[model samples]
Target: MACVAPSSRASPRRFRLTSTAMMESAPTTRAAITAARARSILRAVSGNLDVPGGEPLGYADPIGKILSFNKLEMNEALPPAQRAKQLGADEYPFFGYPGWERNDAANRRLPHDYMHPPWAGQTCVGHARAVLNAMRAGRPYPVKAAISVASNPLLSLADVRKTYEALSSLDLYVVAEYYLTPSAALADYVFPICTTVETTELWHGTDFCVACPSGIQPLYERRNTYDFWRGLAVRLGQKEHWPWENVEQVWDYCLAPVGLTFQKLVEQNGIFGRREYKRYEKLGFGTPSGKVEIRSSIFEALGCAPLPVYREMVLSPQGDPEIYRQYPLVLITGSRFMPMYHSEWRQIQAAREKRPDPLVTLHPETATKLGLKEGDWTRVSTPKGAIRMRLHISDMVDPRMADADHGWWFPERKEAELFDVFESNANILCPDDSELCSPEIGSWPHTALLCRVEKE
Candidate 1:
């Protein structure tokens, strides 16, 4: 979902709708997508569609907008003998869209039928594509295994039920998590992953790099992701492949090229580099053309439009009139918020106190039309399904569209209805149908779909 305002680092200021005094709902009395508004709706997240800008909304747009720079340029120029074809490159060759590094492409390969169509560009084997294909006839991949880390597929992916189906059917589903999340509960094995405070990371920038060391030891058998991988490798008889016993040794090896160790870098307060420009003159552009290709050759070779143009989505109100009639208000999911970091910080008391419920932001006028108040809980339904969210009446959103928090689950209410996952998750209202997916990249619609809201 598109952010109505840019995220501020200064202070996490949020509009608590219940406390707000005045909410004018006049400018958007025409909020419902009935006649004129239907002709000009806020196009959703695929970079293909551009909207008329007012007060700048960001984040969601950037995901697809950057695809024009398709990462194939990073290694596109590699000789065929030195390079290997990436997964889904045959179907969705929007340049490194499969999210596989060039060298690692051969390691993962799906069955022929699964490799064919309904490609999800960046969603990695995609939310639905991977699941659907794995569940397809004749047992393509003999074993279905997923080692989930830093992701809650049940909440993150579209269609909660379908996600459950795929996860349950998996031969071995391993999850690295701190708690027994609804998604983790289904896992065949759950590894306790250490928190950021219990792990080390290099907070690096263009000019300088600094070591952010772990604050405390990993508690109660909790291990970092590195050790987890190493443990797997060791058990699988690939122990020699992982020479380093722990992350510290690995960090030392990484920093050795720069003539520094992690300890040295930390003691020195990190390494600094002089700001340099025009390096392209000395070396060369990292592309097949040796220059930025405004009209990418890779796109042409892969049967995509060479030059960029604002191509309308595969499904539009004009093309899909029947669905629009059923679910009219433009429902945008995956909206970013300050209170939580994409379903992670919900367990934090401070964050929960800041924003208590899953919110569906609607124009004040739109809310009035639908007999909804700022605090009223509403059942938001799309053609796919329905989920409940509180109405956040504000002029921030265009009257014709509604924006809802995407990932919503309550750790406190774990026993209550799948941790109250299905109750308010915006993905519940989103469909994984290939028709609703972006044609060029096959990204399922998280934002562009239509929905209707009602009092719960």
Candidate 2:
């Protein structure tokens, strides 16, 4: 590991990991993701990012790459001043990758905004930051009024205290969700949203496209995200902007590019398109050079390191020697738990029965050293904050590390306690301090965090 300070922005130091034997063939070998022979891989919602199958070459669905729609670039269409003020975008140019950052056809021709938001293109991290900026004394593009769709920031983003402060500061905050989550409970108005089974959705699988049938009509005034936005737009005299009355009609307009209709898509089950591996050979890569950018020129132009670099955790033992003295044990967090979606289903008894308590796994040896045993409630504390978790004695984690599960909340608790979100929730221990985040898009550390564990 060779420490190189390539840029002032990566970190105080960037650890370059390169095999000594492959140093001579650095460009050709896969030992390091250097600028010479590596391709930039950005997954900005062509679908099949983590699905069963997609193009072997990239994460993008071929339907988006090949038969894309002619959606105009919203930001570029704006005046220069307005375009320059695209919330947290100018400061983090990487955030523009989903908008007009890449020179690729698929990304440039972003078809639909859909359930996604305009300010936050792909990087969901922008969600919290946008609010914080709004609360700041003199930050650009401060969000005064906002509407959140089906996201629980209190359990999702790091630094729950800060997130609460930022959210509470919003002048007009509305939430569109199925249930009143901790975050939604704070909203000025909460609109009931329908589930996936109740709302029609156009799902694009590996190589096929299908319209998901609504199992049942939405129960009593519950609406999908699209309808929510359409309704608001119509009331605001922007009805012409949203022509499609419902999602099915919107899908029909989207399918028109392929001379297909939503009704036909449902009737035929699905339509599969053939995959072509080296389509980049014909269209070239999305970089300015029309090739895979191992050392991204875009990154270089943005005053960032062209190649990958590593930095020690902001609160690790090495980074904070004094703090590490009392807090000797290393804590890892922000990982997903099984049988439940992110921060959801806590109210569902079935999911809770499977994994009842929030768990932090540690090697039995590590547990015993702390005078703790299997299934002991441990108070996991970091410099940022602390949370209580049931300790699970296991060797799945290193003896020196305690691995904590994320998204824990007791819905049975009274709403006055914010459903006891502060307890057992991992995000409470994770802080979104700017120094502890990624340089590209301000994405905070989800794992490799530092902390100590003691019996609660």
On lDDT, the candidate that comes out on top is 2
Where does candidate 2 stray beyond 4 Å? 1-55, 58-77, 97-120, 123-127, 136-142
lDDT tens digits, residues 290-317, model 2? 5556566877877667776666666776
C-alpha lDDT of residue 244 in model 1: 85
lDDT of each: 0.61, 0.67
Question: In model 2, which residue pairs have backbone atoms overlapping below 3 Å?
Answer: 35-295, 38-294
TM-score of each: 0.73, 0.81
lDDT score at residue 291, model 1, on the 0-100 scale: 45
Candidate 1 per-residue lDDT over residues 116-191, each given as its tens digit: 1122233324334644455542133433777888688888878787887777777788999977777888889999
